[model samples]
Target: MRYTITGGAGFIGSHLAKALVSKGHSVDVIDNLSTGSMSNLDDIKNKISFHKTDILDADSLEGIIQNTDGIFHHAALTSVPESFTRQQEYENVNVNGTENIFKIAKKLHVKVVFASSSSVYGDTKTIPTKESHKLDPINPYGITKLNAEQLATKYLQFFDVVGLRYYNVYGDTMPGAGVISKFYYCIQNNMPLEIDGDGKQLRDFVYIDDVVNATISSMEKNTGSCFINVGSGVATSILELANLFLKYSGSASKIIFKQQDKGNVMTSQADILFAKQLLGWKPQTTLEDWIKNLYKS
Candidate 1:
C-alpha cells in the first residue's frame, strides 16, 4: 500500500509516517519545514520520499500525491494565541490549505483522514465532549479547524473523509508541544513551572502513539464519512500534571501561577466511545505511565 502524509515531518504526522513505513507500506512525506523539522524523520528518512512543498501549492501537491492510496492530512498552524495575532495566516494555512487537500483528494478519488481538534468544542458544558457536542470554538485556530471539518463534510459526497478531533496530544518530539512538554522542559532546566491561572484548568491529554494508531485505523477501516474524537477520555488538571512532573523528574521546581491567556478554554475532555465503536481504538497510554516511563528511559 502507498500513503501520503502531509506535515509528515512534524510531531503526529512524523510518527504516523514512521508507523506506516514500519508496517511495510510505501510512504511519501510532504512537509514545508515551517513548523516541522527534518530531524523528526531522520530515523526513517531513507525509506520514504520527502517532498518539501507546501499544501497550498496544488500543482506540487497533486503531482506528489497522485498515485497515493490515501492521505493523512496533518498540516496546519495550531497555536491559539498565534492564531489571534495572525488571523489571516491561520485561515490561509489551516482552512485554505485543508481545502486544497480535499480538492486534490476529490480529483484523485482517494480516501482522506484529516486532523481536527478538540478546540472546536471550546469550553463546552459537556464534561465528556462527544462528536455530537456543539462546536463553539473560542479562538481563530479552533475556528479554522471547525471550518476544515465543514469542508470535509462538503467533500464527503465525492470521496471518503474521516476527521479526527484530537485532544491534547503529547509525546516525545512534539512540535509546538503544549503543557506536558513545557513542564518537562522546566524540570530539565531546573526552572520554575509556570501555571496559567489557578492551575485548575482541565484537559484531555492523549498520547501520540494512540493518536497515530487511531489515525491509521481510520484510514484502513471502512468507517465511511464521519468525525470521531481521538483522546484518552480522561481529564487531568494542570496542577496535577505539574505535580506529576515534579514527582517523576525529582525536581524541586516551584510551580508559579500567572494570568491565563484570553481565548483559552478552561476545560476539554473527549468522549471517545465513537472512536472505540468505529475504529476499534482505545487509548492505551495514560499520562501517569508516560511521565513515569520518560524518567525510566
Candidate 2:
C-alpha cells in the first residue's frame, strides 16, 4: 500500500511514517517545516517521498496525495496558548488545511485518519470522558481541532474518515512542545522544574508508539467513519510527573511553583475501552517505565 502522511516530519507524523514504512508500504510525506523538522525523518529519509510544502496549499496537496492509498493527516498548530494569540493562523492550518485534504481525498477516493485532540474536551467536569462527552473547548486551539473534526464529518459522504482524539502523547524525539518534553528538557539541563498552580491537575500521557498504533487501527477497513479517543485511560498529576523526572534524571533541582497558564485544562482523562473494542488497540507503555527509559543514565 502507498500512504501520504501530512506533517510526516513532525513528532507523531515522523513516527507514523516510519511505522508504515516498516510494514512494507510506500510513503509520501508533505510538511512545511513550520513546527516540524526534517531531522525527525532521518532514519527513513530514503524510504519516503518528502515534500516541503504547507498543508493549506491545495495545489501542493493535489500534487502529492494523488494516487495515494491512504492519508494520515497529522498537520496542525498544536499549541494551546499559541492559538489564542494566533487564532487566524490556527484556523488556516488546522481547519483549512484539514479541508484541503478532505477535498483532495474525496476526488481520489481514499481513506483518511486525521489527528483530532483531547483538548476539545476542554475544562468540562467529566473525568474519563467518552467520545460522546460534551465538547466545550475554552481555547482557540481546541476550538480549531474541534472545527477540523466537524469538517471531517462533512467529508465522510465522499470517503471513509476517522478522527482520533489524542491524549497527551510523549516519546523519543518529541520536541519541547508538551509538558513531558519540557520537563524532560529541564531535568536534563539541571534546571528548576516549574510547576503550574498546585500541580494537582491530572493528565493522561499516552506513549507515542501507542498513539501511532491506535491511529493506524482507525484507518483500517474494520473501523468505519467515526471519532474516538486515543489515550492511556490513566491519570497522573503534574507534580507526580515532575517528581518522576527528578528521580529518573537524578536532578537535585528544586521545583518552582508558577502561575498557571491560561487555556490550560485542569484535568483530562480518556475512556479508551471503546478504542480497544473498535480498533483493537490499547496503550502498551506504562508512564513510569517510559519515563525511566527516557531518563536512564
Candidate 3:
C-alpha cells in the first residue's frame, strides 16, 4: 500500500512512517518543518518520499492525495499556550489543514486517520474521559482539534475516516520532544523540576509505541467515523512523574512548586476500554517502566 502521512517527519508521524515501511508499504511524507524536523527521517531518508510543504497550501493536499492509498494526518500546531498566542495560525493549520485533507480525500477516495487530542475534554469534571463525554475545550488548541474531529466524522460518510483522541503521549521520539522530553532534559541537566500548583494534577502519559500500534489498528481496520482514545488509562500527577524520572535517571535534582496556570485543567485521564474492544489495543508500557527505560543509565 502507498501511504501519505502529513507531518511525516514529526515525532509520532516519523515512528508511524517507519512502521509502515517495515511492513513493506510505500510512504510519501508531507511536512513543512514548522514543529517537525527532517532529521527524524535520517535513517530512512532515501526509502520514503519527502516533501517540505504545509497542508494549508492549496496544492499540498491535492498533490499528495492523488496517488496515496491512505493518509495519517498528524500535522497541527499542538502547543496549548502557543495556540493562545497564535489563534489564527492554529485555526489555519489545525482546522483549515484538516478541511483540506478531507476535501482531497473526498476527491481521491482515500482513507484517513486523524490525530485528535485529549484537550478536547477541557476542564470537565469527568475523571476518566470517555468518547461519549461532553467536550468543552478551554483553549484554542483543543477547540481546533475538536473541530477537526467533527470534520473527519463528516468526511467519513464520503470516505473512511477515524479520529484518534490521543492522550498525553510522551517518549524520546526525536521530532516530538513533548513534555516527557522536557522532563528528561531537565533531569539530565540537574535542573529543578518545576511543578505547577500542588503538582497533584493527573495526566495520562501513553508511550509512543502504544500510540503507534493503536493508530495502525485504526488504519488496518478502516475504522470509519469513530473517535477512539489512545492512552494507558492511568493518571499520574506531574509531581509523581518528576519523582519517577528522578528515580529512573538517578538524578539529584530538587523540585520547585509553581502556581498553576489559570486555564490549565487540573486532571486528565482516558477511558481506553473502547480502544481495547474495537482495535484490540491496550497500552503495554507501565508508567514506572517507561520512565525507567527512558532514563536508564
Candidate 4:
C-alpha cells in the first residue's frame, strides 16, 4: 500500500512515516519544514518521497497525494499560547489547510485520518470527557481544531474521515516538545522545571507509540466517519509528573510555579471506550512507566 503524510517530518508524523516504511509500504512525506526538522526523517529519507510543500498549495498537494491509499493529515499550527496572538494564522493553517486536504481527498476519493485535539472540550464540566461532550474551546487553537472536525463531519458524505482528538501526546521527539520533554530538557541542563498555575491541574499524557498505533488502526480499520479520543484514559496531575521526573532523573532541579496561560484548561481526561470499540485500540504506555524507563539509564 502507498500512503501520504502531511507534516511527516514532525514528531508524530515522522514516527508514522517510519512505521509505514518498516511495513514495506510506499510512503510520501509532505512538509514545509517550518516547525518540523529534516533530521527527524534522516534515517528514512531515501526510503520515501519527500515533498517540501505546504498543505495550502493545492496543486502541489494534489499532485503528490494522488494515487495514495490514505492520508495522515498532521499539518497545522499547534501552539496553544501562541494561538492567542496569531489567531488569524492559526485559522488559516489549521482550518483552511485542513479544508484544502479534505477538498483534495474528496477529489481523489481517499480516506483521511487527521489530528484533532482534546482542547476542543475546553474546561468541561464532565470528567473523563466523552466524544459526546460539549465542544466549547476557550482558545483560538482549540477553536480552529473544532472547525476542522466540523469540516471532517461535513466531508463524511463524500469520503471516509476519522478525526482523532489527541490529548497531551508526548514522546522523546514530540513536536513543540510538550511538558514531559520540557521537563527532561530542564533536568538534563540542570535548570528549574517551570509549571504554570498551581501545578495541580490534571492532564492525560498519551505516549507517541500508542498514539501512532491508534492512528494507523483508524485508517486500516473500517471505523467509518467519526471523531474519537486517543489518550491513555488516566489522568495525572502536573505536580505528580514533576515529582516523577525528579525521581527518575535524580535531578535536584527546583520546580517553579508561574502564571497559567490564557485558555488553559484545568483538567483533560479521555473516555476512550469509543476508540476501543471502533478501532480495537487502547493506549499501552503509562506516563510513569515511560518516565521511569527514560531515566533508568
Candidate 5:
C-alpha cells in the first residue's frame, strides 16, 4: 500500500518510514522541516518520495494524498512551553492543520492515524491513564493534540481513523524532544542533566521501536474511531532516568535541580491494555536496556 507520512522527516516519522520501507511498502513523506531534518531520511532517501510541504497548505497536501492509501498525521509544534507562548501558531499548525487533513481524507476516503499526546489528561492523580480519562489539558500543546484527536473521532463517522496518545517517547538519534533526549545529549557533551521538582516526577517512557510497531498494528486492526495509549505501561522517575543515563554513558556529571516547570504533570502512566487487546502489541524494551543499547556501537 502507498503511505504518506506527515512530518516524515522527523524522529518518529523517520523511524516509521524506514520500518514501512523495509517491509517493501511504498512510502512518501511530506515534512515542513520545522523540526525535522533531511539527514534523518538519508538512509532511505532513494526508497521513498519526499515533499517539502506543510499540512496547512491544503493545495500542496491535496496533491500528495491524491493517490495515497493512508496517512500518518505526525506534523505539529510539539513543545509544551512554546505552545503556551505561540498559542496562535500551535492552533493553526496543530489544530487547523489536522482539520485540513480530515477534509482531504474525507474527500479521498483515505484512512488516517493521528499522533495525539498524553498531556491531554493534564495533571492527574490517576496512576495509569485510560483512553477514556479526562481530556483536561494543562497546556496549549496538549489542547491542540486533544483537538486533533477529536477531529479524528468526528471524521471516523465517515472514514477509518485511529488515534494513539503517545507518552514520553525516546530513542537513538532523536533530538531534544523530551527529558530523555536531553539526558542523552547532555551525557554525550558532559553537561549536567537538570531536574525540576525533585526529579521524582514519573513518566511512562516508551521506546520508539515499540511505538512504531504499536502504531502499525493498531492502524491495521482499527475498524472504528479507536484510540489507545502507546506506552510501556511502566512508569520511571526522572531521578531514576538520570542515574540510568549516567550509568550507561559512563559519565560523571552532577544533576542540577531547578524550579518545577509550570503546566507540567507530576506523573503519567499509560493503561495500555487497550493497545494489547486491539493491536496485540506490548512494549519489548525496558528503560535500563534501551539506555544501555543506546550507548552501544
Candidate 6:
C-alpha cells in the first residue's frame, strides 16, 4: 500500500513514515519545511518520495492525491502562543488546509486519518476527556483543531475519515520537537528548565511510538466517521514530569518557575476506552521508562 503523510518530515509524522516503511508499505511525504526538518528524515532520504508542498495550496496538493492509497494528514501550525499571535495563519493552515485535504480526498476516493490534538478538549472538567466530552477549547490553536475536527466530520459525509485526538506526543524523533525533549535537553546541559506558573498544569503525555501505532490502527481498522482519543489515559503534572526528567537525566540544574501563561490550559488528559475497544491500542510507554530510555544514549 502507498501512504502519503502530510508533514511527513515532522517529529511524529517522520516516525510514523518510518514505521509504515518498515511494515513494507510505500511511503511518500508532503512537507512545507515550515517547522518540519529535512534532517528528521535523514536516514530514509533515499527510500521514499518527498514533495515540498503545502496543504494550503490546493493545486499542489491535488496533483499528488491521485497516486496515494491513504493519507495521514498531520500538517499544521501547532504552537499555542503562536496561534494566539497569528490567528489568521492558524485559520489558514489548520482550518483551510484541512478543507483542502478533505476536498481532494473526496474527489480522489482516498481514505484519510487526521492527526487531531487533545487540546481540543481544553482544560476539561473531566479528568480523562472522552470523545463524547464537550469541546471548549480555550486557546486559538485548540479552537482551530476543533474546527478542523468539525470540517472533517462534515467531509466524512462524503469520504472515509478517522480523527485521532492525540495527547502530548513526545519521543526520540527530534531533540526539540516537544516540551519534554526541550526540558530534557535543558536539564542535561545544566540549564534551568522553565516552568510556567506553579508547575501544576497537567497533561496526558503519550509516547510517539504509541501515538503512531494507534494512528495506524485507526487508519486500518476504523470505519465510517470516527473520532478517538489516542493517549495513555494518565495525567501527570508539569512539576512531576520535570522531576522525572531530572531523575532520568541526572542533571543538577534547578527548575526555574516563571509567571504563568495566561491562556495555557491548566489541565488536560484523554479517556482512551473507546480507542481500546475500537482500535485495540493502548500506550506502551510509562513516564519513568520513557525518561530512562530517553537519556540512555
Across 87-111, the per-residue lDDT of candidate 3 in tens digits comes to 9989999999999989988988878
Q: TM-score: which candidate is best?
A: 1
RMSD of each: 0.9, 1.0, 1.4, 1.0, 1.3, 1.4
Could you tell me which residue pairs clash in candidate 2? none
> Which 10-residue span in candidate 4 carries the lowest summed lDDT?
172-181
Better of 3 and 5 by lDDT: 5
Cα lDDT for residue 91, candidate 4: 96
lDDT by residue (217-281, candidate 4, tens digit) is 99999988999999999999999999999998899999999998778899899999999999888
lDDT of 6 at 167: 85
User: Distance from true position, residue 234, model 5, in Å?
Assistant: 0.5
Candidate 1 residue pairs in backbone clash: none
Q: In candidate 6, what are the lDDT values of residues 164-282, reduced to their tens digit?
A: 88888887765464678779778767899899899899988888889999988878884678888988899999999889888878888898999987668988888889998888788
* TM-score, every prediction: 0.98, 0.98, 0.96, 0.98, 0.96, 0.96
- List, residue by residue over 1-297, the lDDT tens digit for candidate 5: 898899999989999999999988899999999899999999999999999999999999888888888888899889998898999999999999999989988998888897988988997788798988888999999998888887777788778888889998888667775888888778888899999989999999999999999877766675567888999999999999999988888899889999998888899999999888878899999889988887897
Per-residue accuracy of model 1 over 1-297 as CA lDDT, tens digit each: 999999999999999999999999999999999999999999999999999999889888888888999999999889998999999999999989999999999999999999999999989887899999999999999999999999988999999999999999998898545888888888989999999999989999999999999999999999999999999999999999999989988889999999999989988889999999988999999999999988985
Ten-residue stretch with the least lDDT total in model 1: 172-181
A best-first ranking of the candidates according to their TM-score comes to 1, 4, 2, 5, 6, 3
Best by lDDT: 1
Candidate 3: what lDDT?
Answer: 0.86
Candidate 4, 16: how far from true, in Å? 0.5
Candidate 3: pairs in clash = none
TM-score of 6: 0.96
C-alpha lDDT of all candidate models, in order = 0.93, 0.90, 0.86, 0.92, 0.89, 0.87
